[model samples]
Target: MTGQLRAAIYARFSTDMQRDASIEDQIRSCREYAARQGLKVVETYSDRAVSGASLMRSGMQKLLRDGRSGLFDVVISEGLDRLSRNQADIAQIYQSLLFAEVMIETVSEGAISEMHIGLKGTMNALFLKDLAVKTHRGLKGRALAGKSAGGLTYGYSAVHQITPNGDPIRGDRTINNGEAAVVRRIFQDYAKGISPKKIAEALNVEGIPGPQGGEWGASTIHGNRERGTGIINNSAYIGRQIWNRLRYVKDPATGKRVSRLNPESDWVITEVPDLRIIDDALWEKVRTRQGALKSKETGVPVWDRRRPRTLFSGLMECGCCGAGFSKVQKDSFGCSAARNKGKAICTNMTTIKQKDLEARVLDALAHHLMDPEAVTAFCEAYTAERNRLASAATSTRTTLEKDLATTKRDHGKLVDAIIAGVPADQVKDKMIALDARRKELEGQLAQADSSAAPVRLHPKMSETYRERVAALIRGLADSEGMEEAREAIRGLIEKIVLTPRADGSGLTVDLHGALASLLLLATGAPVHRIARMAAGGQNDKSSAGAELQGVDMIDKSVLVAGAGFEPAAFRL
Candidate 1:
């Protein structure tokens, strides 16, 4: 707080070919810069083989979350593009960090301002788009030349061409007889009347490895047929190659690539006689059978058997293996990994009935609110904290207004003196100096107004927190408000860790989130005071030690102590 500024270092590289030492090199440069500026490097974050086009990278998310939590005074990165390549994402990140009073310093741009975010962000975004276009064009050329455009396929080995400079250039692929024999068997068996499921089972029985060195499943033999991904369905096996049958684009919500079918007009079909494994006669027979099977299914009457949506679809996780808990049956949720594979894959085979889990969560909430004294203490602490933040914003606004008045008044006097009969050059020089100072003051005032403290819960909101929480819990029992109630629970609870009982009868539920923080505040310790003590490098454990008891305590003690008291989760 006094001498050295605390800095969090962020580094990123976009491709796997880049050495792992890239992160270290970036951090080393940042450390040198920090030392020159008299800053203390407190933490470091990095993302490897991650595209900067999005902010979905794990390290970037952690950096932003920590920034909001006020964990450090400044963030240092090698460049603005190292943080993000998307212009909109750059702007959002800049505003959020600025509002939190944390400065972002880059080695290339120095301390980032709105101007840097705008100009550098646009440049980075353009770079990404141009690079994508060039890469696509190169791949398209390779495909048209009957060469391997991407990774090696299942039944082939890559053929490399050595340049005069002794550098090997990857081009075409040659058949791998060992894997090609297996591929031929899959096509022959499927064409001879064996189902894909039976073929997979036969391969597994023979101890044959699947494409990726794993046990084969029916889906592996019959992948997205339109995209030419499956072993038997691929046209490359029959003297023809299909390229660009599908294209991948990033999903906005998850930032993961989702494949969509490209029109047949866009596909590049090439004749590669050397790559053929199956004869045209066999391929035609297999295609005819597949068409027949599809036609039969298309004629069958479809049943309206859509399953009802569950309340805790994405919230549950297994305590044993840390795998997601998915709805395995109509009324039960089980370990997804175990259910998808076999019980042998995962040791924890516990299943929880949906009704039981819901009841326990509601019961726990009711029990926690039963104590009036604890509720009163939390409400009072939360209300006072909100008022304090609002008061700070008001005070800062008042000071900026006073400074603006004085700057304007001095500017007017300087202008009047210039008009009166003073030497033109001398008066103009004075006036220019005054005008520059006035503009600086105005900029400062605008920033102060724009960076007003974040909105927090008022007294009125806190007073009704108990009733709203109770109503939400009770509403979970009704079918009508189940969706709203589910969201309410998720807002209050970060995750519901269900540790299976040793006896295998039930689960021990552990709650985490803003409500858990209330356990610490019930003892009358203010969150801001604890945060201040923490910021000053002082340890304060008395609050949590006295109030939070037993083994059900949530993780991240600092987060619990510093989180604001807002009832947004309790709102219906």
Candidate 2:
């Protein structure tokens, strides 16, 4: 690589949040940075109205590709926060720069600053999260207000109802087109017992582009392929329209609005005088056909036999045979008897008790997942140490610069003295000493400036760590009135392997999931003792369960180093 440095500047702003004029502010920052380093501002990149959550932006991808081609020795951004809202994506970019020997710099924070990388990427990721919440909130509000929250459906187009000047752009009040025809056709197909997948195929065969002007998706065809701008639950395809079938009301406890499709008893029938799309008797016959076929496929209601429920049933499989092990009991979840009875043909019947074993697993989770306060403490500790190293590095860099300047002057002096007829050996010795000193100083500077990365959790992030631990704990401690929370945890811990005790006693469970197992160490709990469930299959008595004790584990910072969680993942 050439000794002279070159860099590219990347500036990005969301047009949704800031004015287009703000682009100039970023350009100014890049110019000033280039001037400071005496490096060429060979390229400037910007993405407008584009999220920093991904490099999906066309301009941003081009900037990265140019960097990969070794067009520049460095990439500078206004700040690391502007580069990405995702820490993972930021890390990917940082690693990719290694291929070209490219350094990353930001204004205020100069080249190859490792400490700022973590801090800035985290800030950007949080910003992205906030933006997502804001967008979701707005969409939810519009949905509640019966305003369009999605793209124009299959039969409808989104056109301006009011102009920028607040002028009526349609029919003074509004204009409704006869999109009614397209909607009727879709419902007619559904009523004719055509599957949604089949309907999609038919539409594709007819070369009909969906609402997004792309190939049809089942959900797209279902949600928007309705016959009219009126309520989507129009029963006209079933020979009648039921007014007020689905009711919207605010939930009493949460104060959040929810929708419920009401029973037929509550529906009000109304006959529409609009252009008839299909004969009522034909539509009624199609509806009956559809319902009968659906009932048969789903199994008739009365004949639906209830199956015994178990937490890990059908999920736990033998490591050898890989056949799912059915739960024999809450305390002893074991492999299926059919496979086990056949001896070496399959796998051993490993069984584990449910109680004590669960506690040890929870304890492990508590330790590894780390409370937010503890994480914050660790991070604070790590951050302080990093700053100290950076200070030492900066001091060494300053000293190197002085040494380089003095070496250049000494070289000149040695040459001049030789020309003035000083002994050749003396001049040569002096030059050698200066060169050695210069090399030593250069080595010291490189050693100092090279990255001593901070105590980074990296892929083992605080948020994900907290989530995984909390989930495992909740799954084991599925207390009364916590059904939803339990299910969430079950999804996280895909499976648990139980090994029978050496003496043919209850089993010892080794919880997998790399992150989940790590949490066990964090809590300082290693082993669990499992006890059999009662005959009723509810749970064992006398044994205790692990509880969060009202601390919302969700918001606890696994990286923070203190206790007492309040609401959100904030440090104490």
Candidate 3:
């Protein structure tokens, strides 16, 4: 009644658990606890029906932001499980609050960080790990059980079924009569030589709302032109569901990254009795044409980008939208979607020849970065450095884990004594002191694992011997392939900014950030300027420049020796 209190309460429930449990109940419990402690209650945060395991939780992000801003001195929750079901997520949030000097009070668990409290924290972390696994298992089971585990797909609906004994159940259904009619027309139209945009326009002209009740876009039209799902390419119009045309996998290890062509054993198929979107013959024609179209103009296949090709799509970044530019000619490239809709979003389209940019970039990387031998040496050095730190990290983690275990055992004894009617103030002081020590140990353990022992590598050129220096420089100059180039680029050069380096009219290379970071750092020398630098005493820029390295490292200005080289048309 006398003073104001500021508290933020957080609650979460994953997708599996019926519905998100009561935030009101959590808040009420928190409010009562705050009242008992004569503390004020200020703000509340809730993420209704969102997984705590997800990295992009907006509710948790907002809570951390407000907490760091000092809008709340304390955060109350039902338990650690409600706040997060992921250990890493919980740890990150815990660190945020600890750094911001906020107190975390759990109504049921009391305060944090006694040997017992810390043990409970570990248990809470374990609970989340187990919860994430359990939730995934349940979902996979539901999906395997021929249930609609997710939303109604673009062309299908949920149907009711009855067993032979007459009990009813919900089942995944066939294409909707209305949507199926639309699907057949789209495939037939495409095979008859209609473009995707034309198909989209025709659909819009007829006023068919797209899958989600929006005006049809090219992407929507393109995506729905699939086969076998009977949504797009139903081989079944001639009567058959090609049950397993394609499959995909979501790998959990790397955050559920999708992979194509999961094995046939993984598919589930139930044929519709009297439904078909497109006939087998038409499906075959569409598939053949689509394959041909793709082979003619290839994109980077969905594989690892560890070995980057000098593809125009990889090198050219749009100055306006920051999207990578796509190739227009074998010589030059422009934006893929710059003026997508009547020059609407972006009207500016810039093009640059491939050979001109590639040569200079390769040379610049060579001059700045180390080559293959140096990278191998560096990798060896880096591995040793990491192992040294890893050893120390392991040692420190082991000690804290032991301490945490001991503290938990002690906490159990304290709880038992309290429950048996121990005196309040006497037991309370001991619990608080134990909690504080546990928290301090935790801080030390976190700091050790985070910043850890330093990697020993002298940045000073003088400290490095002449052999090492030669190896380093030569590594950049003679890096045999793209991997060495990329390594040297990542290590020495900060960023490679591309612009019209020759008098702002022609393209050239500039390595700025890491060049400055690594002194003896290589900087760009546009041909006009380099010629002047080379002429020793002559003003080469006024008269333009002369060819030196030909098209290998210098621009056409240098290749032509004051006369621009004849532009050659390259067949892609």
Candidate 4:
């Protein structure tokens, strides 16, 4: 309609398993299409692993904003579906662009008219509905057959290999023994009335990664209550497969996805007792406690919302039982597990005076970080220990590099063999096997490289590190902004596990992450030695518990201290 058409490109993919290159491919096609139409491509926007049904996507929003600003006369995409699969969302997007006098051109559909938008949008929407129906039907069938219907769960791995006929063989959820042990531990701990937050802390301290191979969150372990979903509420743990408990529906107004609870009658419950991870008694205990907590939360007054309790609200955990320490009474923090189920349920029954805990934490921060002598001592010890770890990891790195290179070479050879006319079927199997090995080796090498890299002190460590750390501490400490302070603490400390002294004298402050590194630096203490000192070696899992205790206070503090702390074992 105007001079050389200025076009903007939009591309998206719904899931990460879809190659990231899908976005690039879509953009490439759109550019080619624009070139053919004598259009000048001005800008390109892409949202990877984002659903088309949701306009909450950053790229989509930016495209809309730019369209409104009259930055482009034409918007180009690979297809109408790339813009949106939801009929309402597509109509809205088309109208918004049309109102701005911007025209949409899809590579497949050419220029979009009002009729094209109406018909194509409806068709895309219908296609999505049909896909959902087919997916649900297949999942329901799988559930009936006692097979997993979705992604791999925490304790189980999906059997991924296809059958000879190319049909994916189902009903093959194999329990990962290593992860299963952690699952059992979670059930046991929860049954004993240990809070999810504490359990997460214990797992982190023991260097046991969660489902996503990262630090665990309470939500990840406890799950959502409305849907009766999550690792804690999953009926799969009780030897039953519950399908269709929740559905994600796109909101017409916002073009965003919202999760809705499905009716019980609609849920397809399947019996698979052999698949159960938690025992009946443990499941019952956890369920009962969860029900009680839900009731408590439901009755809480609006004014008594949980967020305002303290600066260290979610960061504190019961050192003994690994349950979260929550604000029990005014100016006091106590283990939620102990408060809910009594001291009989949890041994960490002592309530910490909030002011006292806060003071000690701040003091520890100043003493270990702000003092010039302490900073020098910490820097020296930190650098020495880092060098030692780097030396130890050198051999491991070399071995992994060799393994990766060999696997890649073998993969290249297999590819060449296939090109040279081996039986395609036989060669295909070998290629798959070789590719899998190559991926595994590459992963190992990548991990090795990351771990082997030394955590170095800032260049200003000798001259200005102390002043910088002190200023950072003061900025957080002097601020009345609870959110800012909380955020700073989160960045500095991985966790603060509070162990009530068995002698009833006081609480032992165990630091973790960067905090531990800083302390090790200041004290020139070995990891286990400091951990023992912090934990007082009072409980079972003495070494682990002790290490956990010592590690609690410091966590990500190394980063805060301007002396980076990697969670290397041999801390000075």
Candidate 5:
């Protein structure tokens, strides 16, 4: 490396518990190293309070993007672990930088390489695992001693104290008198046959703050019975502390932690009489009521249900407060916030029959939307954009083709030299580098060709769309394949907003269809299957929306061109 080499500094610290100045310290050391080597620091990137276990951090991603764009010649970090603690992630970063012809230098490791990534990555991963095990052990001891093992439950406040050695005591809590009174009131209300939704509404009306000082919600009161969550299910109010009831594991694909329940035998139960908020009589009464309610709704748990029963179950929203519209009765839907959080949150008390709402929305989808003129205009616009993109891709493909030819020609020369009695070792590395470049260029050319492939729209796209929608609507009437048809139809809708009419007639409905999904449905494609494939086999509700925005194929104004209904006063 020469003194004129350009370098980018990258630094990161793991958690909020760590000092913010840790990033500054790491950057300072990297800068000092760069100065000592006479390397020009072109830029610096830092991720504060972000874990190195994942490469999803914004700063790290930006660094990799810049590296690939040839913004710098080298990356200077505090250590290899600062880049990533995950073995696979570290290896990926190394290969990416290698391909970009960028070097990685660290203060602790000097220069990173394949060997360093393997050994140091393993050590860092082990450190994380060991730390987790030790932390869990300490928390388990605290739970066994009847101290809080996790977050402070509602109706309690953290009790901070110092030990004899002047060390701060952790995991101690005391009952909050005001919150405890509220908890008792909730138990009394539930035992007296008041539903959780009604209790939540009354509490909100009284201006009582729910957990975390947020507005009260029915789900906050009536939590999962199996998970023993929610205010009512929390056994801490009954002088019992439960620990290790659930374990969380990080999803490899998403880098998000998902929780799994532990068996009852694995749960640790401890008694703490001093923290009790509800007496035995009130507790038993609440439990009995909950058991009776559970018996009444015994078929399938809501979480276990694969799909919603109704066509517009999760699609309706309240225009006034931007809250969801849910089933308020056996045959109608209304603003959930108004019904559960009271008029203070939302004044929209308007309700619409399920049959009527479905009929209106389906009619709009089949007839008003997807006009022939609009469809033809959209096809023309898509064709023009596709040609423009193809033209750009052709230029890129040409460059890649030239580069691939040059690489192959150079590789051939090295091979010829070796065959002409030249030492194989002298040209082995050069030939290998040229071969890698040739393959990379070929891959890029292949991708460009695929993207530039022409797409043709059906001539009678609007008619096809209407026919598909009609078929789906008719399928809703039949029992066979009804669920599949329902899911497909639902996938096309983004949301349906209902607002109260100014003249007090009734609620006005506004439907927003996902443009990409509508186009796919119009082309006789399975919208649900395409969306699921895009989301890696998961049913992502927003995948169609994402594709529409990312592809930029359709104009927004064309969405409801022929629909007679005026646009809603507000958009959600």
Candidate 6:
């Protein structure tokens, strides 16, 4: 029986700071142990730089799956804690393996039992808690002593030195003159009523690197106010170092860390006046502007708010500067960069009435788009792809049904064994595992069965598309289900480009409809291939708009409208 038994090696180390060779060493030791135990080492699994606190690790999950499938009769790890540190997780792992008739043996602990899991898991959990408390305490002391307690802030550089006792001095920082200038400029510009988006665009145009040394974006400058995260909210700019303002906890469902605000009483504030980058007056001005903006937003009704309320609010772009077009007045949209960052960044100041723009776009979509030839081409390609995917899904559903049937059979055998006088304790874990696997397989089969049916193209697809567009236009005038119709129509458009007419008369509109969305709207069937293409398409307006200037399709994937000076002709 030992000679026939198959063994699998498993190992894990918590962080990148640990040695990569640690995994190799653990696996080698496990192989040697398996050889001595007269078992064939058939597979190896390891998770590098992954914590034992969660079973979300890919390697661990694969090991469990293979065990349940009866690929391995025994699992070897360096220690019980290597599998899991949490008591509940370790117990669950044990039960899962036991139900699958797989034994776990650690090099250090030998064969694992319930007693080992309970004792070792509790010890490891306590160790993690103690480590966190001690680490926080040390950081708090460093903060109180006027030293950096976290990652180095953007405008500061680390000062490395050695203490007299031969220990390295950590957390000392000095102001970076170059970065300090940028920080001061940001504060000054925001104080003068420049929006964060405008500030970011202007800085990017001048080739200024952001906090992470990449292209700047509005969110980088206007981070969450309540969490005090953005550049403008950094208290360090005012000679204050605030520590413990937020606490992070791991989300059990997703195994990701999320931050929560800590009480002000728990905060540790230190004065590092030498590192000051912004003056009190400039800081106060930024705070006042932030407050005023917040108040203005709160006082407005939700429907009339400055946020994206119109159909094409976020999809409109300026042809001159490539910045987004936003509402500049009560009823008109203009280039945001030109109005906010001045003419230096963008020269286009053209504005168009919201009503006129919508009317023109809707008219183009209904009358000029949806050519018969293009619709036919899209239908053939879409039907072939949909049928291929449907076939693959059917094969997958068959496999799931087979696995589910096997799980149910195994569970019935365990029940019969219990009824025949086998101790329930001996096979209870296996029965539970089989039941869970059966349910999981059944769920997957149900999802596969519920997938959209194979698409059959309508003979008059283009006509249907035109009729749908007309209905959508009518829906805009009605109050009931207006939002739904607006979203449906908006989904068909990738973006709209607005440029100042050469004669300085008005804005020239260029509408680009997404090919995938158009095909879906026309056929009333899902087209997975074209949908992926549209989703993954580049958003660089300069290159895309130039390529689409007078063309119907760019690389046979997009539909362009307003190909020439006339703004009402949509082509595909």
lDDT (10s digit) by residue, model 6, range 1-572: 43588899999999866899999999989888888888898999999999888888999999999998989999999888889887778888998897577999999999887668778988988988988899899999999988999988989999999999988898999999999998999999989988787888788778888788776766678777667788998999999999999998988755678899999999999999998899999999988887777445366422223565787778888989899998889999999777655565678988999989988888878876766766566556556666777687778777777877888888999999999999999998777668777776777777676554544566478798888778877988889857667766776777788888889999888777765466566765333323333344344222332222222233235554323222242522
Candidate 6 regions exceeding 4 Å error are 1-16, 19-138, 162-168, 185-208, 215-227, 247-260, 279-282, 285-308, 317-324, 328-356, 368-375, 386-421, 452-457, 494-572
Q: Which lDDT value does model 4 have at 398?
A: 78
Winner of 3 and 6 under lDDT: 6
| True lDDT of residue 551, candidate 5 | 39
TM-score, ranked from best to worst: 5, 6, 1, 3, 4, 2
Across 142-169, the per-residue lDDT of candidate 3 in tens digits comes to 5555554445555566687898998766
Kindly list the per-residue Cα lDDT of model 1 for residues 389-418, writing each as its tens digit.
558767866876776688678878867777
Collision count for each candidate, in order:
0, 25, 14, 20, 0, 1
Model 2, runs deviating above 4 Å: 15-29, 44-48, 57-62, 65-69, 98-100, 108-112, 159-178, 194-208, 215-572
Per-residue lDDT for 473-507 in model 5, tens only? Answer: 88887897677677777766767889999999888
- Candidate 3 differs from the real structure by a C-alpha RMSD in angstroms, to one decimal, of 14.0
TM-score of each: 0.60, 0.39, 0.55, 0.52, 0.84, 0.64
Which residue pairs show backbone clashes in model 5? none
* Candidates' C-alpha lDDT: 0.68, 0.53, 0.53, 0.68, 0.81, 0.77
- Best prediction by TM-score: 5
TM-score of 5: 0.84
Writing each residue's lDDT as its tens digit, candidate 2 over 381-474 gives 4466567766866775776788778987998899899899998797786687677657766766675554544324332355665665565455
